[model samples]
Target: MKKIAVILSGSGVFDGAEIHESVLALHAVEKAGATWHCFAPNVEQLHVVNHLTGEATEESRNVLVEAARIARGIIEDVAKLNVDDFDALLVPGGFGAAKNLTDFAINGAECSINADVAAACRAFKDAKKPAGYLCIAPVIIPMVYPESVKGTIGNDDGTAAGFNGLGGQHVDCPVDDIVFDEENNVLSTPAYMLANSISGAASGIEKLVTKLVALA
Candidate 1:
């Protein structure tokens, strides 16, 4: 069986991982008959957010701890993810992805990915393994690829511009469509960036997972 590594940001849509996207990604993994191992960076979140109020809060949270909420307590520190244990990697979108996995939300194209996250993603890149990224998670595509890699984020101008700065070719995509960077073995979709419902997000996500597993 193919072992797919799932990297989650947090547990919520406001402060961490988008619940729908995260769950859907996992479903796609299972549907493909591939086992998935969850991983998260063991670090403090940039800050906490009250999802209901959409405001910053005073509580400090660990990225891995919060991510475990979504993984149902079965997850590992991304720093310890062994390349040999997984055939592919997948990242779901949420504010936490930009905030915790990489600082693209605050720093734009100049953002730096968390060291452990970078290492995990780079391991797949170095091994020529395929990866699937959804929503803002695709912002880190360039960081893992030396050449200009092609990806999409539902055509958000500012984000696309930032992707360009990071040495990536941003293609405008819709919620139901995906961008396949064949040479790099990378797949991405706009997902919630353009979806009005969970099913819409799943359309592209399912395709991405299918393609990624096939590549693996």
Candidate 2:
């Protein structure tokens, strides 16, 4: 069986991994006959957000601990992820991706990715393995691959610009579609970036997972 490594940011959409996207991607992986292993950086979140009110709160939380909430406790520190053990990589989007995986949410084009996250992702690229990024998580693609790697964030002009600024070739993709950088062996989709509903997001996510597993 193909083993896919999933890097989640946190447990919520506002400050962590988008739960829906994460769950949907995992389900799709399993349905594709692929097994998934979840990982997260062992660091503090940039800031906590009250998902209820969409406001920042004064609290501290470990990225891995919060991410475990979504993983149902079956997760590990990203630093322990060995690219050789996995066939492909998948990173589901949520504010936690930008906030914890990389500082794209705050620094945009100038963001710096967490060391372990960068190492794990770049390991896949260096090994020529296929990988997929969903929603805002594509922001990490440019930071991982070479210049002009094609990616998408569901046609958000500002985010697209940031992606381009970071040396990526941003493509306008819809909620039910994906942008594949065949040359780089990378894939991206606009999950919640354009989806107004779960089924809408699943359309592209399912396609992405199917293609991702096939590529693996």
Candidate 3:
């Protein structure tokens, strides 16, 4: 069986991982007959936000703990992730991906990836394992892999420009489609980046999981 390592950012869409995207990815992976393990960095989130009001909150949370909510408390610290044991890696997008995994939300093209997160992704890259990045998670791809790659986060002009500036080629895609980087064995999809509904996001995510499994 192909084992995939899934990296989560946090718990919510505003402050952490997009709950829907995270869950959808998990569902697709399982339905494809592949097992997966979840992981997250054991570090403080950049900030907390109220999902209802979309305002900053006084609360603080750890990335791993919050991410655990999505994994149903079954996850590991990203720092200890052994890439050799997993056939592929997958990242679900939310603001948490930007603020926690990489500073792309705040720094855009100049964003810096969290050390542990980058290390985990790089380990898979070094082993030549294929990976899938969803939503904004693709922004950090250039940091983990040297080759200029193709990816997508919907068709937002400014965000796509950021990917280009960071040594990646951002392909414009709809929520139900995927951008495949053949040379790098990487797959990326828009997910909630353009989806107006959960089913819409599922289309691309499911395709990504199937393709990733094949690559693995």
Q: TM-score for all predictions?
A: 0.98, 0.99, 0.98
Question: How well is each residue in 28-146 modelled by candidate 3, as lDDT tens digits?
Answer: 88998999999999999999998889999998899999999999998999998998889999999999999999889999998899999999999988888999999888898887777
lDDT of each: 0.92, 0.97, 0.91
lDDT tens digits, residue span 36-143, model 1: 989999999999998888899999999999999999998999988999998999999998899999999999988999999999999999999999999889998998
Number of the predicted model whose lDDT against the real structure is largest: 2
Candidate 1: worst 10 consecutive residues by lDDT?
10-19
TM-score of predicted structure 1: 0.98
Worst 10 residues of 3 by lDDT: 140-149
Pick the winner on TM-score between candidates 1 and 2. Answer: 2
**Local error of candidate 3 at 145, Å?**
1.7
Model 1 CA deviation exceeding 4 Å by range: none
Give the Å error, residue 210, model 1: 1.0
Model 3: residue 52 alpha-carbon error in angstroms: 0.6
